[model samples]
Target: MTKQRSDEPEVKPFKGPAGGWGSVRSLADILPREHLGPEAYRELARQNKPDGFMCVSCAWPKPADHHPAEFCEEGAKATAWELTRLRTTPEFFAEHTLAELRGWKDYDLEQHGRLTHPMRYDPGTDKYVAVSWDEAFDEIGRELKRLDPKSVVFYSSGRTSLEASYMYGLMARMFGNQNLPDSSNMCHESTSVGLKAALGVPVGTTQLKDFKETDAIFFFGQNVGSNAPRMLHDLRDCRKRGVEIVTFNPLKERGLERFTDPQNPVEMATLKETAISTQYHQLRAGSDIAAIIGICKFLIDWDDLAKADDDLPVLDHDFIAQHTKGFDEFAAAIRKTEWADIERETGLAREELEASARIYAKAKAVMAIYGMGITQHVKGVESVRMIVNLLLLRGNVGKPGAGPTPVRGHSNVQGQRTVGITEKTELVPVEKLEAQYGFKAPREKGLDTVETCRGVIDGSVRAVVGLGGNFLRAVPETGAMEEAWPRLDVSVQIATKLNRNHLFAGRVTYLLPCLGRIEQDVQASGPQAVSTEDSTSCIHGSRGKAKPASPYLLSEPAIVAGIAKRILDDNPKVDWDGWVADYSTIRDAIEDTYPAIFKDYNKRLFTPGGVWKGNKASERIWETPSKRAEFLTPGEISATGFKDADGRYRLITLRSNDQFNTTIYGYHDRFRGIKGTRDVLLMHETDIAAAGLAEGQIVALESDAGDGVQRRRDGMIVTPYDIPRGCLGAYYPEANVLIPVEHHAEKSHVPAAKSVPVRIRP
Candidate 1:
């Protein structure tokens, strides 16, 4: 394995749906190498039974009653990983050099097999050699003890279980450091930052059940079917009830238009697809600010018309006067924005905007759902505020079926943030440490993912212990982070399989094999149940079924507990053994730490689903200074790089049907007719012709905002699409090459993945 790209043959266009059996056919080539056999596979599938274990793939809510084929296509791939027959033995690692492994494709790494045991890189041989778990722990402990607390950064992925995340945070705090930058730091940090500023909370306000009561759903920058297929069921249910679903995106995705659920037998057998969107608008990326402003302006105008004619209620005047502030400023700002500017930026006509506003005015309840598309802009935080402003204008925050929902990406990404996986200013994590372990936590807000990479490049940060995730590829400015890795003193990855980041090991690197979500987790006490927080802030348990692939596959919590005990100074109060032995104690500790939030964790979690928090606090009670939801007007519209560039396209990063976030299950993006390729851009035919480019022609995309950054991903096939004029879209991680690391929102450190300025050349 040298640093060569995957040499698989160019893929043919997607023919049809890869049904359960058809999907298995697609994996035929790799099945011999990756399949764990029928016995293991069946057990793995059984383990995915509703009561057995949660789906290791996406965070889509499961049905209360078990459905036989409940898992999605991507979920099956994740299950396959758990039940894979291949194993990464010490001998195999000894045969391949680190440099050689660097050439492997992203999929090939996972295809290699489950890592069997702990391994340390042997600089002499340029390959990894077997290392005893005890030895590896001792080595990491020694390296951590030597580095200054400030020079080390601990990173976690969304895959980490809640208990593991809490332990990781506790371990870092005990080591007198709060330099914790996690996966959430990259994706939904803007949601947290924006929602917290407007609604006094950082998480989504609505749950899945809320959709059942929704009268109207304003979906912004989200592809419901592709990103979250389970949501299609809810949307389909709503559609059946005559609920309106208005979709806004840069491109017209087929999944958004019609979705045939694999779980529904009637639809699956008849090959019938459910209609999803009632009104689909091709919103230009980066111009979301304009779209939101237009909605606000329409609301204001409706109010004025209502007042003059004595017709009806346009703005919720009663709600506004009783429960809000700063309306005059918001109203004045709305008045200042002209319809011409809104139409120009949003690429929507005045009539369409008016029609949408009319619907909003007439709706008794409205729910707005958004994803990375809305949060990955230079003015992303402001765009989020606009959504809040719209909701606040109608008293949508604490209602039954209405509120802002930022559809989260990862399984436990939201949980990780809630468990204190953050780089806070006061380093209050240390204060918690002192209260629990009798040690003062550091008093510095550490660098986030982007800042940590900068620190590594500048030599301020010398080491990183990533609990999980592909850091190099996931971070913006991949070239910089790749170069910076070699400069670090130590780098460690506690993971299940090899990823792109594992190959970019530093001077002192170690890959500690850990258990997957579906593998059996045996602790000193016995089998343990790991807790996870859903997108709705509901906590539940996940238990593994299949036997560990190897005796060495330790659970995440066990791995973290082992490292915590070995690295930190021994404290009687810090009972690492007790915590690892019984996860209930961890829950107990969590309850103690956030009693008002996690009261009766044990009793409540025992129920079939789980319990909800903030119910009492949500009823017309704001945590803000005034104890009421505030209407903060961003008086002036924030300008983005898109406005100044006349003909340049605003590129948005998207995940293919076969992918999830940064993880590429395979190259085939089935729904879009793309297969075995990441080197392609989706664009409007008009935009292509306007740029003097032809379909199927390869072109380089130059970014004016990327500050001369070069995208090595050349020769990308172009496909004529119904995207908005001057708007472009491409797969992320590859598109990460074009987005500069420094390009970020002012308030939130989230890199702009939605609104990027670029020009195409043939």
Candidate 2:
């Protein structure tokens, strides 16, 4: 382990809810660092508005009645970080070599600010040199033409707008490749797969308005404060309205405990916060399936007892008979589940589980909200289905304030998948796509994020063209991906700022700077506003009011058009240039491709509060093969298999309050009371003592993945925290190396980032 610097940040316990004056102080301190002036606040006010640009942060839905300041702390940071005055010009790259830049931290690399010009890696000088956009595109096209189409992987991030993603996906198919992998494969792929299998739809059943009307809201495995701060407002309102909020997670998040809305001047001045989470249950990591099964079993027993006493039935028998199938089988399975096993697996007493079940059984309407914590496990898909089963037992679906909702991590991530950026053959049928576009779309499914990593290592994938995101840093097993990515023939990054991915240049690497979400995008026809779908499936227009960071920067649509024009020049059926001229042309194409959902794409997109592409399950119109919402029976839960030895603990990766996804805004995690550094492991006090480790002691963590490959990460300091026993918490990307790349969810193939078995070593 590396020696700790004497200037390491202090660590203490935070006693307040997530948002308060602390957020204000943090915003004030960060504005000047990014060279943002008073105008930045005005710019933030325009975000998520009908005429303003959408925030590129979390995917939380915008309120119907837009607030003067709709942006959260993380959104403000993301906006300021992109619109900063500091520029990473060609001259800046000339001063620093790739090796020198590789030595810097991820935070420092992006803090150097927006990329201002197109650059190509020069092996002779070991630095990136300036190049014209056309030359870069031509070189990329030439390299791509040399390789087989199957050998190329086209990756898209969630920050991309629907119009650009549509063009990108179309271009990939027209180029005769199905290897389209997006950031969703790493984050919310489980939500898509699990929900589709249960409810006949991939998206959430409820809208943002449902949160206000919900009688009870269950938060499973999500830390809303840091990941989606705007959600705190809804939870606070629910608390004020006497709605019950129940939380189940390994670690106690401040946002779930209490939240003082920054928008409330009275609460802000008085320092009074609204208490959230009427019942908080600290379950073990990866034990969600067990806990859910226990709750269901208890509900079934309570219902049976109610019927025996000639009282009102606890279960919705009529809804079950009319709208669902396989309930009898599912109920039988739940009945057979032992309460002792549930108590052992979930690390909770039987009485506690029954109490929670009673609260749920009493509610008229309930909303089950979850995040990556439930979806980033080995049984993530099954866990998600269990959540659906719980909701279905109570006839929550197709109701006003009740359904299953997976709080997506990135803005427009769900939208990207909706606009044909998917690897599933069933989701985007190749035959339909080929018939519509006059191109031979590949029938076979493409590689997902984990498969892409394996493809890169096996020399099957030769090139990677990323639309946006830090792919290498964001994925698991960073140490292995960092090595495998540079071995590719060509790599292209369409981004606004410098990230760690830029340093991992292949034989031929091109960095094409693109317009940020906050910048105006003027096409050949006129100024255009790209549309993005929120967490609630509301497609809203996003038009940038701020000027472009650099004149050399191109719109994502324009860049995709340029590459498509060069690669598929012989294909006359594809009108790449026309799509780039006006974003509406692309939206028209989207409507033509997915007419059932995207009808009236252009007209409805401009409507106030955007258009709601309604979910079938939300309307009791199941489109499954059975024509009914199905009750999925999940397998048994094994909660004791995570440990290899008595001292081994489960490690769950998480984000800090000062960070959003892979981007770090600062070193301070105000909610967790950590400052100055990210190299720390959060552990229970008893676990720290059991491992013979003291507070602030540097240690190494080695995973027990059982894949015969040794995965270890060092230089992690042990810090006492309120985490569950036999579980440890650490920041992602740093802890990602400890997670084996091969270990992922069964069906969705999303990396099991939240539950890794590891042993702490001195």
Best prediction by TM-score:
2
TM for candidate 1 is 0.94
The number of residue pairs in model 2 that clash at the backbone is 0
lDDT by residue (347-427, candidate 1, tens digit) is 888877777777787788899998888787777788887888888888887888888888777778887877778888432
* Model 2 pairs whose backbones collide: none
Error of 1 at 394 (Å): 1.5
TM-scores vs. true structure, each candidate? 0.94, 0.98
Task: List model 2 lDDT by residue over 442-545, tens digit each.
Answer: 77788889889898878899999999999988888877788888899999999988999999899999999999988888988988888899888988888886
- Model 2 vs. true fold: TM: 0.98
Best by lDDT: 2
Runs with alpha carbons beyond 4 Å of true place in candidate 1:
1-33, 39-50, 63-66, 425-433, 615-617, 635-642, 706-712
